[model samples]
Target: MMCGALYFTPIGRRDSCTPSEFARFENDEQKGSKGGRIHKNKKYGFKFVLLETRKGYSIIVGTWSGIAYQGENHERIESGPMITIRHPLWTKSDPRQDIPIMILTRAQAEIANDLSVSAAPFGPQEFSRNAKFVFALPPRFDYGDSTGTEEVREILRNHPLHPF
Candidate 1:
């Protein structure tokens, strides 16, 4: 259970990340698990590409991000995640039941460690068992502004200036 720093961006249908960023991210993704080209270890689960600082573009893609309030017919069918993985960035705002699988870069994890929160760092042991390793943005990103912040807070809570 390597307590590492990880970065995550919801891969929306329209990825906001740039091509260079995307290419770099894609290369990293394959390193983790063989999503397409070649099959790596099942336990690796994207671990190979994700060990260091990684950038990812993902969409919650559950169709829920754009979902509006609906009737009973729209209820999600799944009872729960088939499994759980750990994320280093998650804090008290995050669930304890989930596993923080991704091994983040030292620079990335440093920011999380400084959040004035009582933190936990998982060791490398948990990697194979957990399944995913994410890289958090490096520190120096600022969270200082308070304008229109509520909207961002509803989800990311990332300060527009969050020095990443």
Candidate 2:
């Protein structure tokens, strides 16, 4: 199956967040895990929201909400779980398992291996571990792209598309 990679960009050290900000981030993470709504921009399509990474843990929360800035890596990893962490904006259920987890292809996995990037598949039984947050590397994109891909990359790099 065709897949894409979403590169993990560090925003800040978890310890660096103010208490309120950390609380809010934790709250948002919990809500998403409990089936809260993941936001999407109507005009610009989807905003790849910010997911957090802590200093020690290997599991990271994928906000599954937020905006993707221009030129940011926007490839979707295929082997990752597409489990819905949030309720659909207009529906009671979302059947997708691709949004909140990172699944890598064999080739991508090898690339990740070479790059020393970890791509661990959460075991089916561990889905009930009940951890609200975790951290691991998001996939990296390295394959060559077409002209259209370059155009999209250019668009992502340009910031007028950013609302904030």
lDDT of each: 0.26, 0.27
Query: Candidate 1, which segments miss by more than 4 Å at Cα?
Result: 1-130, 135-142, 146-148, 157-164
lDDT of 1: 0.26
Q: Can you tell me which runs of candidate 2 are displaced by over 4 Å?
A: 1-115, 118-142, 159-164
Q: RMSD to native for every prediction? A: 19.5, 18.0
Per-candidate TM-score against the hidden true structure: 0.20, 0.20
The TM-score obtained by model 1 is: 0.20
* Candidate 1 residue-wise lDDT, 51-146, digit = tens: 222224221211101111134444222111111122223234432222122233343233334332112232122212222332232222223443
Q: Tell me how candidate 2 scores on lDDT.
A: 0.27
Top model by lDDT, which number? 2
